[model samples]
Target chain A: MTPDALEGALRRPFAEPANDRVLDAAREAFEDVGIQRTTMRDIARRAGLGRATVYRRYPDRDAVVAAVLMREVRVFLTWLDERIDHIEDPAEQIAECFVAVVTGLRGHSLLNRLLTLEPAAALPALTVDAGAVLAVARGYLAAKLREHQQAGRLRSFDPEPAAEVFVRLAHSMLLSPPGCIPADDDAWSRAFARTHLVPVVTG
Target chain B: MTPDALEGALRRPFAEPANDRVLDAAREAFEDVGIQRTTMRDIARRAGLGRATVYRRYPDRDAVVAAVLMREVRVFLTWLDERIDHIEDPAEQIAECFVAVVTGLRGHSLLNRLLTLEPAAALPALTVDAGAVLAVARGYLAAKLREHQQAGRLRSFDPEPAAEVFVRLAHSMLLSPPGCIPADDDAWSRAFARTHLVPVVTG
Candidate 1:
């Protein structure tokens, strides 16, 4: 279908499918010129949309960037869910999650580029901002922990705090992996999860 | 004592007492104008020495900055040792260390200023760059862990890697504390250490 027709069909009251197209274009522009230099016009042009339409969808470049980052995070979390959905044991599930997250982030082209080129902008969200993405991550993990606790698969603890620790640990390693843990070593990552992480939520 | 007399009394073969003066001067300059803008001449002027004397002590501004950073780390380590030296329990020691470090960094004038004014230059040491300061921190912790393990107080783990995790966790929290954990809550910080950290080094 044509871009116009596709957007018209995909646009919802709260969100639109065109949002994805605009963000994808924004991601490309950001990669090419770096986030600091990429403009709304560039994204609009790349998305095959008028500046007015792009502005209607996203008010500014910062809004577009936030959408792009959130979209990326959602996509990654979806992949993560699928990867560890079948694991029965919480320990195994967390271990797999750690290994998968580290491995996935290591290969993530856009995130790696941003970390290398635009760390000043990107690092704050992972580190200091504690914004929507982190809240979503913590909520997701907490729900899982709660579910397992109800099912008698896990011990009783404050799942929110436990999930918070898990999320921060994952973020810390991804942003600035410890020197002692050699990168790309899945066995070591899993072992670390088992040794250091598994005990946090378990009895 | 006069500067010249002090230098004669304190100078060694490889490093001289003047090095301390130069580094102290550079630290002040870095704190005032930031590492990026602070020049060797500024440091020399602050040290009450000639440009040639400062240059002889440190080859360049970067060298002076490195020495200043190392000196600061040494001072912090000395303080940390004194604070946690009397804690007998391994878990208690680790927990207190985390609280003390977070508290210390929060109050540190130079570090707080650098983090705010020159994050681009100062952040790498805590995150990406594995510098001498980080190495010294990890080594100090590892030595304590090793001693504890030998005394049968903690688990038998690779002290270096364990120390690396401890150091990185502290750095992560200092650099980007989790939103889940409230800042400046000594109780929460200690609980986090007891829950997540003490396990790694203790059985």
Candidate 2:
């Protein structure tokens, strides 16, 4: 499926209160026992909703998982927007965004837990099946780059591919950070971004 | 383990003729039944060697898998070296290297089969447990960048981290491959490397 379609489907469940309850319950269950063991009925029981109600909103557990993951991405994007909104320099903004994403994802509880406990389940979502997450993040960065271009702070370039490259750098780093690169160090991440990532936009 | 140590171990099996036979058999078995189902005994039988001989070389199936992957990396690196041997400009060389790697990997039968049939097994080796592979590739690029620096073709920077970034970009692109970025297109990949990757070295 196209990333936009997948992202739209993921966002649809956010509009309903019942869906919110379902996601909250799914998150709790996932944290308690893990995603592999969290059944549809278990989610319904935890949410205090009927099985049919949960099914009406989400066709199966995978859909619920995708929705939960998308919500987390939304939360992350909002936090990222707030952090970088004040920065006017395109280079520094991009650098700080990279730092924030790497640090934020490193501290993310559910993602770390899933990686540790159930890599089989978590790896695919982050790697092969990461379309929705990648789409949302690339969109966020592309929009920011466009704004920077409009403000005459950045040159005219296809922001989409540049944004994808930036996002992928962060994605690869978080998944399997190389030994040469320091992890979770704010100063190091910032410097690396300035040297490596800023050029992608400014050049 | 350190990447150097892992790489050293991965290369050790190459000195033995029996090890080559074992790896060939293991590759065949992996291509036939997939890595998850390929066993030491199966490999030994296919190689016309005793189980003790196989066990003596590799303590387990995981070790065999690592050795096979490392061998493939070595072969690819050799091919890459030959392909870019005559290029004078560092930017064009890096661009061509990226194109070669992305295209070479996309057509790799064993790696492709594993990624398609047993992502659970393949993903970790490329992502979380990718230290050896990443180390080998990064080391190769760092050496090349260092050569450029020595020859005054490129400015001095920590070639190590820069190389890691290059390798990780290719790594992530091969694994997830965002929709915004065109795939398996030589012109696009080369242009991307020039626009996005060359800056990491030249800037």
Candidate 3:
């Protein structure tokens, strides 16, 4: 489901202000603290709703964390699909995508908190089913690679493995931020697009 | 001093029957209850030594843990350096190193306990001092890669980044093992030598 669909499912009555506020609070509060530490009561307080109202909306902590993460992933995918085509080379596209993925990661308080703060609790929530996301990314890269092969713009190599390398490289970049990963991160996207990213496209 | 120097020093002074027994006890106790939870007094009791005797050898808890870890690294490296040449191909050697590394990791009760039982306590140990151990591993890999490159058997690339990738991949394999990694892992070394590694060595 899309982010909107996900948000829609949370609100049973469709116009329930309490449901929307609870979800917003859950997103913010979970991002601030963590899913393990964030309480339904805190969400309710932030949403200006009663404890009963939160209980009415959602059952427990995991659900809220899931909702927020799902929304973020959907948003990220949507953002990525828009900007991937600007770079001409398929390999470049893949590298830029890796750059893009990490670039996308830096500003996300929820993802940052999950990664940098509570890895034990955060790993499950953040990467519960990363295969689907990886598939989406791989599919995009594979198609682009195939296109380049057809155009004779690059040498013949297995697009699938190359795509996997990009995905894993992106993973490594996140796991241990390189010197170029950006302090303020204002230039991370561009720098990654230029260096680690450009090699993929050119290779 | 290097792990070799440390090993030689520890051996000359303490490889007699009594000291060996104490170290064995300390290793087992550390594995059973974690570094933080395992006490010197408890270790001394396990080793059949008085508190004063244990304290006489290693002044502090940290000292004992460092000694144990140092001992473990020395043995693993010495073991690896021997079989490292048998693989012949640069690709196979690197791949073998990964599988061997994992197998060696399986029997490491202390490292396993540190990671599984108390990650918050263990992360600092890995990161506190400019990541010296990681730098050492990176250095070793860089040297090996350069050696292979000089022999005209492997692809020439920036060894530093390649070593970084190897380290990151190996580390991830240790932390979050996926189904792609072999459980039995006997053929893992040769299999990696064939599929993932051979092509890159040529590049």
The TM-score of the first chain in every model comes to 0.86, 0.90, 0.59
Which parts of model 3 have CA positions greater than 4 angstroms off? A1-24, A31-37, A47-74, A86-88, A101-164, A178-203, B1-27, B34-78, B101-130, B179-195, B198-201
lDDT for A92 in candidate 3 is 55
Interface RMSD to the true structure, each candidate = 3.0, 1.5, 5.5
Q: Which candidate is the best by TM-score?
A: 2
RMSD of each: 7.3, 3.2, 6.6
lDDT of 1 at A177: 53
Candidate 2 lDDT by residue in tens digits, A111-148: 87887787777787787778878878888788788888
Can you give the TM-score per candidate against the true fold? Answer: 0.81, 0.91, 0.64
CA lDDT of every candidate? 0.72, 0.82, 0.59
Sort by TM-score, best first: what order? 2, 1, 3
Candidate 2 residue A97 Cα shift, in angstroms, is 1.0
lDDT of 3 by residue, A1-203 (tens): 33344334333323656666787898888777777788889998998889887887688776666656655665665677677867776645655665567667666666776666666555543332344444444455556666677789866765664555455555444545542234345355554445434444452
Fnat of each prediction, in sequence: 0.28, 0.62, 0.03
* Candidate 3 global lDDT: 0.59
Sort the predicted structures by lDDT, highest score first: 2, 1, 3
| Residue-by-residue lDDT tens digits, candidate 2, B5-123 | 43464456576788899999998999999988887889999999999999998999888888888888877877788898688789999999988888787778898778778888877
Poorest lDDT segment (10 consecutive residues) of candidate 3 chain A: A1-10
Candidate 2: which pairs clash?
Answer: none
- Cα deviation at B202, candidate 3, in Å, is 3.7
Give model 2's docking category.
Answer: medium
